[model samples]
Target: MTTTVAEELRRRELERYILEMEWEEQIRTRQAEKHFKLVEDVFRQHLGEAERMTIRQLITGAAANGRCEAMVYSFPARCCTDGGRAIEKNLPHWQKTLQGNAKELYHVFTETAKPQRYGLRAAVVDFAEGFPAEIGFFVTWEPLFFRSDESIY
Candidate 1:
């Protein structure tokens, strides 16, 4: 078969376009991997080996125990599993109880499939020059059991 000049030029152009797209995809993948690695390193740095093991145990325990719903941890305080509604109190009262001034309060939640078909919500209360208060709540289909009575901060 005889190849026309225009047809040959079109084929080469198509090949070049495909190569360019592949190269772009590779670049994007590398960038994403690098960013994720940096994030993992930072997360590891913040939590020591023992702390990481403890956290892992909590998560795994929750997944294993059918009755276990949520785990709570108040910084500078002991960890608890009674993740019911948080008792509402005035900000000033909390500040005094925390033994430090309040800086910021945030509520963060993430859906996961590992433990169960549920979402993990955390109330992070940052204190000045002190450990933050954190309440990790498990959100499941049964609102009656795992629902938080207090509004998320």
Candidate 2:
């Protein structure tokens, strides 16, 4: 089989696209791992040893009866996945839920990037109806660039 010049060029372009996608995925994976560690550290400070242990169990426990909802938000970038933008748009609903649910706590998993600059922030909350009865949970990640005056970080 003979390969034409056009076909060879097309093949190279496809290969390049695939490589770029893989690289991007790797970057996201590293970011997520960093975020997880940050979350653990922040939670350790806020909760007692026993409480932290319990929370850990709940977070990692597969037996817990609940649904996990995850969201990722990115801003200051013209291009983002639909999933990322959807999470950003739903902030109001999540905020309202957080306000109403007395038992719920938004544990910030991680915040990355420069202060007053482009960055990523993430949080998770487990909603439990009663003892060990976690009904559902929500996780959110937002990547954004902030103005100097903004203080949400």
Candidate 3:
């Protein structure tokens, strides 16, 4: 009086698929170029070109810069579930959508980085000095709950 193994396997398969949400590992990888591209697109939606760029070399172009940006975002994504939105101003919903691994992605530009890090860019130097007041304000000063209010400064 032995239970048939084939029936047990089929039953188990059905039970597992029906009852379990297969856990997937969304191990985060930061693609900084895409992030910057999104920001660029977003900024373009809001502002015109503040500066113009010419690609003298195809071997080196926006993609190279994006590769650098990717490195910046990938250093450690401890803050955000995704890079599309950020979570500094109590905007936790914009946090890592997965609910645990998201991190503030601003360090990619703000930190006084060295070659050992992301290498210093002469073009980006000025952008860093004016950060908290200029660029940083946009990221750090907004509050999450009051969508219409500009309460922080």
**Rank by lDDT (best first):** 2, 1, 3
Per-residue C-alpha lDDT of model 1 across residues 26-145, encoded as one tens digit per residue: 544443343334223323544467744554455444433433344423443223222112312223223223222111211212212223334433344443344444433332222212
Q: Between the candidate structures 1 and 2, which one is better when assessed by lDDT?
A: 2
Candidate No. with top lDDT: 2
For each candidate, what TM-score against the reference?
Answer: 0.32, 0.39, 0.18
Instruction: Provide the overall lDDT of each model, using Cα atoms, as 2-decimal numbers.
Output: 0.38, 0.39, 0.29
Which residues of candidate 2, in runs, are more than 4 Å off? 47-139, 144-153
Ranking by TM-score: 2, 1, 3
Clashes of each: 0, 0, 11
Model 1 lDDT vs. the true structure? Answer: 0.38
On a 0 to 100 scale, what is the lDDT of residue 125 in model 1? 47
Identify the runs in model 1 with alpha carbons over 4 angstroms from their true place.
45-153
| TM-score for candidate 1 | 0.32
Better-scoring candidate (TM-score), 1 or 2: 2
Error of 1 at 93 (Å): 28
Q: Model 3 over residues 1-153: C-alpha lDDT tens digits?
A: 787999899999998876433211110112223233444433333333542111112112333332332111222222224422333233445432322211223333233222123322111111223221111112211111223343222
Q: Candidate 1's error at 22, in angstroms?
A: 0.9
